[model samples]
Target: MTLRLAGGIDVGSCTTKSVIVDDGGNILGSHVLYSGTDFEGASDIAWRETLSLAGVSSTDSICVFSTGYGRNSVSFATNSLTEISCHARGCLHYFSGPMTIVDIGGQDNKIIKLDQKGLRVSFKMNRKCAAGTGAFLEEMALRLRLPLEKLNDLAKQADGEVTLGSYCTVFSGTEVLEKIKSGAALDHIVRGLFHSVVKRILEMDTFTDTVVMTGGVIEHNPFLIDLLKTHIQNDIVTPPHPQIMGALGAALYALQEAPHNMD
Candidate 1:
């Protein structure tokens, strides 16, 4: 029997991810890497790693789709789709319902509305600043001398309340330091930071009963779930592997492109 393969690559500000899938929509292999040096090089690395994981080579795959900020720079891609479309398609494939997708990436945050069929109907994205993204949290972590994974749990333990000012990450860091100097409790300050970022996301004006949040930050940030519920008055859903949604979405697209009988 001949093997059929298709692939998708997503290059974001801080990471590169790719997926390889068979004609049947089964994920044959996937990989993630840091986007170092430049997006083009990082994308190439992720594509190669993804193919290797699937025990296939780029020459063996018939179709390649590139998404994310660096999609246009991946010359090997047969077609380029915006991450918005690919993410929506990907999320719908897994959840299979009418829902809103909240994707918080390393550098940006987006809200996508999907119909009952899992098709994207509308979307809003905040990319001009790093206020509500993983990068913002990383910066705060560095300044607070706290591990990223511990932030959510620590925030949940706050004994008092504090309000963080500024949406720009750098300014927020400065504000956080000032609060620290003023004798603010660490947990309260941390929870305030969560509120600050969540507020920026709320400004997007997108609300839905069923919402799914994905990305690296959400993977370890339990505080965000409470923050989201408070702002949207809705529960937030997260997949077991929230960080891989983009890559999975890309693979779904590849499956739709490859024509063959795998079942």
Candidate 2:
């Protein structure tokens, strides 16, 4: 018998992610990389890398589903779905029952509420501003002359308290500079930034008893999860491979929607 596989590609604005899974819903391989300027190229690279990691040849027959901001750009996709559906599906894969999903992407953030049956009840998204998204952190990192990856660790080290008054990325960046001039601790400022991100998300919608956080931002900066727990009394959790939840959902959809025999 031939091995059956399904694949998912998420062509996000800032990064592309690919995932492969077996019929049993077990992830076989996954890859994440920057989307850069070419969404097509990025999706191709991510898919190839994911296939390679899964020990599958390029010639293997598989169904591929795509999602994310540039989902339509994935020329190889067998079908496509919205990021909201993908994220909610992905989160439900790990945590059952009703839950709220908070996905902090590079360009925007989403809040998805699912019912006990795992169906979406309502959702919210923030796209008009970058203040609470990954781009905001990246810009602040640049302004602070710090590497983006270092922000999580710096925020973890914060011993003092600081607050950012601006919800606009540009104004917040300026506020960061002013804070620096005032000799505020760098770690404190970073922590404040993380706080701002959590605050922004909280303001978007009310939470359920359980909240599952996903997306690259939360994957890299788990400190944000801890911060969220402090602010909300609900149970906060993260699914395995938090960054690739969308791709995983897409892959699951591929498996469910595709025929068993591709040969």
Candidate 3:
């Protein structure tokens, strides 16, 4: 029996992801890698690797779609779609209704809303600065002399509140140092930093109804979700594979656009 395959490659500011889906939109295989300075190269690496893992050959007539910051740079893609649209579609697959999606990525943060029909109602994004992004958290981790992987664990052990006033990456790093100098516990500062990320997203706009969080930052820092729930006073939803949602959405698009599937 021949298997039908559809693929998506999402090249973001810091990472690239690829996912392959079957005709029914079930994920078959996926891969993720650092984007580095070589967006094109990283995209190629993710794209080919995922296909190989799925036993799908590049020579086959499989459909591939690309999305994210470097979508247009994916020269071999059958088509390119915007990251915002792809993210909304991907989240809808998991949530299955009208909802808001907050995607915190390496360099930017996005607030998107989808209606009951899966149509984009409105959207806002923070790309002008690094504040409240994955980069901001990494910078804070360095300032505290903590390994990036330790941030979540440290946040879980906060002794007291230590809110950061500044949102700029550089300014926040300075604030972290000042808090340290003032004898703030390391865990307190880390938890405060997590709160700051949630604060920045809340400041974006009031997300209505159900809110689903997606992206690499949300996947890595599970503590932020808890903090978000505390601040928003509502339960939050997340996909099992949050980091690759964009690529999954893209693959779904590929399936719809493939010649055999098009009505």
Candidate 4:
């Protein structure tokens, strides 16, 4: 019997992710790339790379779904979904039972509450400011004159004693500079920044016992997970590919919808 494949593309504000899966819900291939200024171009590249890794061609009969900020830009999508729904479904793919999802993305952050049956109970999002998003971290890294990739390691080396008083990104940047001028330890400052991120998420909403985090920020700086765990004092988890959970969820949706499309 021939195998059926399904594809999902998530065009986020800062990154685009693509995933291909088999009928049995197993991932075959996935790819991630910067979204840049062209959402369509990024989606095409991500989709092509994912297909190549899956050893499939563009002509294959795969159901395609898209989600995220640029979901509407995916001209090839069979359908598009809201990022909230996709994130909830994607996180639930790995973890069962009622849970909370914290997705920290480039431009914004989301907190989704799910009931025992996997239905969305409610959600909160922060889009008015960059305080708790990846953009905030990048700006902080720029102010610190450190590479963005070094944040995780530097944070891990800290004593975790430092705490930033400001939650606004601009104010936090000024605060970081003040700490530098005061001869504060660099590692401590980094950890403090991570602390701010966790604090921001905590203020977003109350979480359930099981909290699953997903998105590019978590994928890169996993130490934030440890920080969050300490604060929430609850079970926390992340999927295998945190950055691609939206795309993976989209693919899972495709798998379910594919049968209806059969000739």
Candidate 5:
């Protein structure tokens, strides 16, 4: 029997994601893995797991597309697309109308503005600092001796307002410890961390209205949606699985490539 299957693999700084879809644009399987050493090897591991989850074999698959930071290194992909283009296509697949995409991954964050048809109009990225990225949060979590999820949950419980004073992780970590030494409430410090991340994103402050958030951080901290909502001045939207949006977008692009196959 022949199977018309298309796959997409996303290799990010912290994690790898793969998505497989049938001709009808239905997800057959998906997997997430860590990116270590060469991305080519990592993509293979991620794709193998995804195939296992879908209960399929290499012989049953068709074209594969790759996206994300390491797309160029995916030897098996028929083609590669930039993460920004893939993300726009993916978000447009899930929702329509004016959209602004905010993706906070392990090493960086991006603000992408899309038009009504899901076309990217403009975008800004922050790769220079860790303050707005997951790396920053992970370091802060280590300092606080709290699981990252617990940090966000703790932030949700804050009774008093607090602000983190530094954009640099080292300075912020020092200040955070000082606060703890002074008997400051744990929730206050947690809230301050979330606030600092939001503040850093606001520094880009380029897009407006219909903000849609996607990334692993949101997966761990759903309360970030509310915290972000408080800071933004426009409508907000998020998909059911924002963390997988990049991979999903890549799959969506595969579908678009063969519309006749997409039922």
Candidate 6:
């Protein structure tokens, strides 16, 4: 059997994602891995792992595109694209209507707005601090002596909401400790942390019609979407493969933009 494949690698600050797609844009295989400090290694592992999952080798690849913070480090990629362009492109694949994209990633967050015609109208990002990103949750989890993955479940235990006032990661950590000392329920505090993340992102920019959530954070803590829906009146949407959207978009780029004759 012969295979026509396009691949994408996204090396984010916290985690890396890769996706393989057929000519029809169907996802054949995908992989997600911790990025750690070595972007090159993350890129390598993501590509190989996805290819492995697809039961193919590099020889089957038509082209590989790269995105995210470490897009330039993916040595085997035919080309590279930015996370903003890639996310917008990727999210549009799911809902091609007017939508605002909220991507919560490892070290930063981005709000990308696309019009009904699939053109970017405006965008905003938070990279100055770890206040609203995945790092914030990781730090809060550490201070609470809980695994980051447990935050969603913990937040579900709270009946009443707690609003965390501090957006600074350091101060928030201190605040969480103070809350614990004051005998606040761990679950309420956890929900408050989730609220703070959504609050910080909402404060970044004004959103439009349909709101879409993407990225690793959204994938792990789905409760964040429930919390977010409470803030916005518009219906919310999440792509099927939230964590690998950038990589999928990159693969789509490869399929569309890459030379058909290229190997």
The Cα error of candidate 3 at residue 28, in Å, is 0.5
Report backbone clashes per prediction: 1, 0, 0, 0, 0, 0
Q: Tell how far residue 51 is off in model 1, in angstroms.
A: 2.9
Score each candidate by Cα lDDT: 0.79, 0.91, 0.87, 0.90, 0.81, 0.88
The sequence of per-residue lDDT tens digits that candidate 3 reaches over residues 1-263 is 56667889999998999999998888889999999988899998998888788877753668889999999888778999998989887887788667889999988899998888888889999859878999989888887788988998889878676988986888888888899899988899999999999889999988787889999998889888988988785558999999999999998998888767333
| Candidate 2 lDDT for residue 244 | 98
* TM-score (C-alpha, index-matched) for candidate 4: 0.96
Query: How would the candidate models be sorted by lDDT, starting from the highest?
Result: 2, 4, 6, 3, 5, 1
Give the residue spans of candidate 5 off by over 4 A.
Answer: 1-3, 258-263
| Deviation from native of the Cα of residue 74 in model 2, angstroms | 0.6
Steric clash pairs (candidate 6): none
TM-score of each: 0.88, 0.97, 0.95, 0.96, 0.92, 0.96
C-alpha RMSD in Å of predicted model 1 compared with the true structure? 2.5
Which 10-residue window of candidate 1 scores lowest in summed lDDT?
A: 55-64
Any runs in candidate 3 off by more than 4 Å, and if so which? 261-263
Best model per lDDT:
2
lDDT tens per residue, model 6, 15-123: 8899988877889999999998899988888788888898876544478899999999998898999999889888877888699999999999999999889899988
Better-scoring candidate (TM-score), 1 or 6: 6
Q: Tens digits of per-residue lDDT for model 5 on 1-263?
A: 35577888888888888988887667788888778868999998888888889888763346777998899888888778878877777787678858889988888888899887677789888857777788888998999889877887798989875677887999999999899988899889888888888888888856565999998887777777888888778887888778778887888777666434342
Give the per-residue lDDT of model 1 (tens digit) for 1-263.
66677788887778888887776767777788888758888887888877787877445445778888787877787777888888887777667668888888888888899888776779988867778888888899899999988889888888765887686888888888899999998989889888887888888757775888887677678578788787676667887667767777776776677656354
Q: What is the lDDT of residue 225 in candidate 1?
A: 78
Deviation of model 2 at 34, angstroms? 0.2
**Best of the two (4, 6) by lDDT:** 4
